[model samples]
Structures are given as structure tokens and as C-alpha cells.
Target: MNNILTLAAIYRQSLFYFAIRAMTILEPQTKLSRNWHQKAIAYQLMQCFLGLCRRLIINQPPKTLKTHLVSISYVAWLLMHDPSLRIAIICYDEALASTQLRKIRQLLRSKWYMALAPATRIRKDKDTETLFETTAGGEVRALSVQGGITGHGFDVIIIDDPQKASLAHSETERRHLEELYASAIANRWRNPAKGVLIVVMQRLHVDDFTAYLLRLRKDTVHLNIPAVAPVDMTFHLDDDEVYRFREGELLEPERLSDVVLEELRTAQGEVHFQAQYMQAPVKTGGCPINPAWFRTYTELPKYDYRIISIDPAFTENGGDFSAALVCDVVGDDVYLVHGEQVQCDYPNLLRWIETLDKTWKPDLFLIEAIGAGKGIWGLLRERDFHHVGTIETHNGLPKLRRMEIVSPMIEAGRVFVPANAEWARQFLRLIGSFPYGPSDDWPDALSQLLIRLRDACMRAGQHRCRRFPPDPPPQQTSLRYGMHYRKYWL
Candidate 1:
């Protein structure tokens, strides 16, 4: 009897030990496997329950027992210590939330749990799948991100897998969850000072809920554990305990072997694999141009030709920015000298264009024919601006496809940008984030310049510039003539 009591005392003290024992009782069919990552996660969760960390975010690979450790065992452990604690477990959907709640209830109701923490009994009148209460007034509510929690409040909120991987690409779905967090979920804490908010999930998008929360809360305690270690580092779990991870080490070699990881990588593709397993999400639809591919220049080199490319937006407010890039073509390389993106009306946009032209003194001006581009082109011509031309895109080619066509030049170190320019930083960010980013105006304008430059070089019989064959010429009738009898078509 004394030995059993001692074991129960130990279980109540250490969450990690309690998790091992509880998981055995809950899942008797599967053999329990131990890993240090589990201990690391439990330690952080314990910190949250103790009020050491108010906001916590844990980003890890999928199916590594994140939900089991965080949603089930942690909730039950918290109740064991204080049955009056009100907790909420939230998931992407009601089904997931209910599933987690059921597991917690099972663990609480087990004979082993009854022996260890008999005081944390479920109230007979308040037992349900989605919500239940203890005899001491402790409440556990299960909810989906789409559900409402207006009338109730929680002392501890656990958001587990609040985003579905398949729907991560849908902007509407991502925005809806973000809006819910900002407006509803963030304000539902019972005690603002003592409440805890914990988020645990695999990364799905660059702008997913995890990213959104981190941006809003700079003091959030982030525990990022990838399936495979990208570098050798030491994680200080506690004052005396530290987990040292070596480079290229598998997070759990027993379950997720190198062979299995390879298979998953092949099945999920590079973009999904990097996001889900590595916990480093890139741009959606696979970023065509890698940011590291572009060469950097501190000063402009001697250039033979210079042109300005513009991608204009129709609206002056609450829409895409009117973007322009001034590029210099020196021999076979293209140097991005200056760039700007602003939200303004047509008159201001025209003035901005005139300013760029006069400052740079470019040999040609290539403006996209869509949106406000035609208006800008006609007005520039009326103003007698030299070497003005409108770029006509092929009907069948999409923006993504056009970017893919010009990516080789960037990858070959033929594209250059200022090393320390603020505008260059913004330009690279938009280019790197591409379709997944908020705006594509910068990339669109840059792609127009590269495509046109490539075509011109091909026409001049530059063998080194023939990375891709030029698109068949557009019909002469479809061509838009410019001043000085010059021809312009893309």
C-alpha cells in the first residue's frame, strides 16, 4: 500500500511520468514508446500551467503525439491538481475537439486515475462529449475554431491543430480563422492576468495562425521542434535538464526513420514536406524563385541598356499597389537599380512615373497593358515621354508561368539587387512570398522586364541569353504602336 501511494505521489508531481502512465491506461493496445521531445513538450506545458509562461506556441511535425501530450494528458493533469480550473480545448473542427475531449474523459474515468486522483470526479449531471464539469466546478469545454464561446470563459485555452493542412492554401479559410482569433477567442479568458494560451500545431502556411499570433505577441514562448534537426543545438528544458540535438538527427528515429521520411517527402512534395515536417513553410504553390538565387551588388556596374517596368493597379485605395522596377541590363546580367510600390490615384501614379523616368533616364519604358497600364501608356505618350511602350502579355500565359520562365536567369546569378536597400528588401520579400503573399505587384513588374529582356536578347542572336526560346511573335494587327515608329509587343 505504501509503495502504491508513493507511485501515485510521483505521478501527481511529474507531468511526464503521469503522461506515460495515463497513456498506457488510455491506449492499452499500443506499446508505449519514449522520446526526449515528449519530455521537452511536457516541461513547457507544465510551465504554462504554473503561470510561468502566459502565451506558448509549439510548432512540431504531425502525428508525433502532440495532441495526446497537450490536449489530453495536460488537461487531465491540470484537473488533478486543481479540479476547479476551467479549461477549453479547441481544434480545427468539432469532430477533432470532441475526439480529444473524449480521450480526456476516458483518462479521468479510468480505475487507475480513480486510484491516483479520486477527488477529480466527473459530475454525473454535467457529463457530455463536447463539455463536462467536475464535482468541484472545474469545467472542460471542447470547441472548434468556427464555434462560438461568447457566454463562457476559460482559465486555460489550448488550441491544437486549429488549421487543416488541406485548406491552408485557401485564403478565405485562413482569414476567417485569423478573424475569429482576433475578435472572439483572444478575449475569452476568465482571468486576463492568470490565464494561459497555448497553441500547438504543425506549420501549414507562412501566414497561418501560428505566424499571425507570433506577429501580434512578441513575448510568446515559442518551442519549435522539427522532425529532423537542421543544425546542432542545445535546448534548455530546465535548469538541470538540457536536450542536445545534433545536425541531421531524426526527432524520433524509432517511428519516423530516414526511409519513412523520404517516402513522406516524395508523397507530400517539397513545399508540403518543408512546411509539415520541417516546420519551415515557404510560399504556397512552391516558390518559383528562391531568394538566395539573386546576386547582390553594392554599386551599379557599367550598363549598356536601362528600362523601367510598371504594373499599375486600378484602385487607389484598399487594393493592390501600383508597382514599378527600374532595371539595368549590362551585357547578359540584369541589375535591379531601384523599385517602388505605392497606393495612389492615376494622377499621382503618372507623376510617380515621370519622376522615375527623369531620375533614371532609362532607354525604354515597358508598362503592362492591363488595369491602369494602358491609361498610363497613353498619357505618357501624350506627354511626349521618350521610348514609352506598352507590354502585351500572351493570353494563355499566367503570372505564375511567366515567373517560372524567368526563374532560370535569377538562379543562374544573372539577376542582381542592391545589397542594403530597404526597397530591395521589400522587393525580395514579395518575390520570395509570391502567390502566397499579400501582394504580387512587385513580382509582376519584375517578370515583365525579364521576359521582355530575354526575348530581345534572343532576337539579337545572343547565344548565352537563349535560356528559353522566345514565344512566337504576336500578330502585327494586335501590336500597339508607340512614338518614333517603334514597335512594342510581349
Candidate 2:
């Protein structure tokens, strides 16, 4: 939040001094670690500042293109030679990766490394086709990320910015990256000493694969240098930029952003671009609801009232989780109470619901009608679901209408949600994407249930007279009555 213009001016005043300050952090050894050559870009950027730490004063010329290419080529070569070493050279886009690959080819083609060059044409390997080897017995391969190609047991995993299907501000793509870490990419390291993994990319995310490595790996390294870092510090932020929605945008901010950001509809416009460039906190801008609202309004006593809401996806291949959440409502806050799930069709799912009705003793039961909603409602009616029964059964609220009402309540501090439940976490991820993907199915159900409850309160005044109370049991006739038909006939 510093005055960016002033910081820029100060940066201009002593960029050399700042670079000197940056270099002072890393102490150099007469001989650097051999494997250090293979560290990622951000780690290399950190080295420029480390030189400042030296007791003797020494100045080096400004870094050049050759310096960067040489560092990259040096690392690429080691990664290729090292067996089971996983290397990722991710660029901002496929074009960037391809361009970097060409750079690698150039390095290999260089006469200096003639000893390592292949003897003849290298054969491409795929689908048990005739095996091809590098001229020097090495292997070179490339795959377009958009092709959705996957390789296993990779001696070296060279990925240059393997970005596809709309990079930058895509939460879906980000989620895919997380899954790749948990299921696909991380699974590659099946052995204890399987391989060394390296990721080279700009700081696109704080939760990216790179960030994941930064947190988990002991040998992780990073290098991040903006185009204007040498001459300016608040180098990215400028006056025209008002809202930020991406990393690049957050890097630069105008002096008056605080005053301006408080009042703008940048939601549909350049908000995404600015966020990327400036690196503004995505948590604040992208969240559908504010934490303060939940904090202030949340007064639910621990595990109080049970709330049961369901999500019903029509088909299995739809790639969705048909979920149910049981929430406990206390004074004003909410807690996850219980959950029910079924993967099959209507009859079984209905039986599952009936069992839940019996077990949880839910005060109210909400069933989502997005897919087989009508049939489900009919089945429940046929099963003799009574309003006064142990648990009341109600139709689900419309998903869109529900979101419209509940979203603001969430933002205004009138709603509270538990964070511990698997359902809640899933709900948050889907809500973060809003109407973007299939995962939204679960949150849609919860939102609809709450909205229907609100509408029920509105109809309270008109309900009493029109509401047909459950019929009274048939009256008993006494033999003493005038007719006395039962006794006389006997």
C-alpha cells in the first residue's frame, strides 16, 4: 500500500543501490553447489542480489540475454542427463513453451556441445511404434498440452508453460493443476528416490504447483524479476488501473488505488487483467462472500438444529457429485450436522432419503428438483410424507433464485458456515467458481433450501386459514346412543 509513484521515484533514485541491497542477501562460496545450476528462475533472480553481501566491493555489468539463455540451457542439459529427473519449463502459454523448446534445440545444435549431439536423425516414440533414440542415445520429445497427452515413467519431464484452455484467471484450470499434483503429476514420483522435479514459471498463483513445491520441497528455488525491476520498484501499478483480478496486474498499483477501488464496477471489465498484472490479493476481490459477515452474524450454538439438503445429478457420466449436507443451526450460526449420499437411481435414492428422514430426525427436509426433482417429489408424496410427520418434506427452491438471495446475505454478514466439513470445503470451491462448472451442483442445493425457508416466512400470514389441517380421526359411537345399531344387531 505504499505510495507507488513515490516508490517508483525512489526506485529510480537508487535502482543500483536496491539491486545491491538485493544481492547482499546471498553469500557466495568460492565454488557454488553443482546442482544449483538446475534450480528454477526465481532462485537465479535471488542470486543477483546475493552479490551485495560480499565484504569486498565489486561491480558487474548489467545482465544480458546470453546470461539468461546460458543459465536455462545449462539447467536443461543437466535435467536431460539426470535419470528420473522431472523438469517443468512452463511458460505463460504454449507458444512460449514451444519458443523455449526451440531455444533448447538451438543449444543442442551448438558446436560447443558436439560431444553430446546425436549421430543421425532421432526417431519419435509413440504407441509402441519403432523405438527411436537420440543420435547420442538421448531422447527428445514434445507434447502439446491441448492434446491432453500424458506420459509415464518420464526420465525427464520437460514442461514449458504447459498452459491451455484459457490461462491467467481460470479457476477450473487452476483446479486441474491441483488434481495433477495430487493424482497425476505427483504420482510420477512413485519411488523414494524417483526423481528431482523442477518448475520454471512466473508467479502466476500463490496456490499453483510451483507454490506447492515451494512449501513442500526442501531443495526448492525460485527467481522472479519483472521487466522494470532494475529501474523501478512499484514498477507495475499505474493510475489508469483501478481493479485487479490477475497476478500481473497486482504487480503495479497507482498511488490512488485505495480511494478508487472502493468505488468501481470493474467486475465485468479489466478487473481480471489488472489482478494478474498487479498481484493484488485474489482472496479479497474474487470471494463471493466476506469473512466479516460470517463472523458477525454467526451465532449458532455448537451442533444445534439439523439441516438436510440434497443435490441430485441426473446421470453418472455427467461428472458431478450428487451430495447432501446436514447442517446444525445454533442461535445464528451454522455447523455441518451430517451427510447422506447415493450413487444410483430414483428408487434406491428415495429409500436412502427415507432412511435419513428416520435417522437424523431433520426438522425440515429439502430435496433438490433440478433433474429428477418432480419424480422424487411424487415418490415422497406417495410415501405419505406429512407436514406434521416426524420430519417435514419440502420442495427445493430454484437454484438461480436461491443464489441471488443468499449470495448477498453471505456478503452482508447474515450467514455463517462451518469450514471443517468435506461438504463445506467442496461447497466453497464450487461457490468460488459460481455458475462456472458442474461442482456448483452442491452449493446450489444449499442456497435453494435457505431461500425457500425465507419465502415460507413471508407466506406465514396467509397460511393459517388456507392450510388444511390433518383430518381428525373418525368419532367413536357409543351403544347408549339412540340408534344403538351395533348392540341390537348382535
User: What would the C-alpha RMSD of candidate 1 be, to one decimal place?
Assistant: 13.3
lDDT over C-alpha atoms for residue 159 of model 2: 42
For each candidate in turn, the TM-score is 0.60, 0.33
Residue-level lDDT for 389 in candidate 1: 70
Residues 4-65 of candidate 2 have per-residue lDDT tens digits of 55544443333222222222222223222221112222223223223321111111111222
- What is residue 49's positional error in candidate 2, in angstroms? 21
The global Cα lDDT (0 to 1) of model 2 is: 0.41
How far residue 259's Cα lies from its native spot in candidate 1, in Å, is: 0.9
- Give stretches of model 1 more than 4 Å off: 285-490
Per-model lDDT: 0.83, 0.41
lDDT of 1 at 409: 72
Residue 475 displacement in candidate 1 (angstroms): 46
lDDT of 1: 0.83
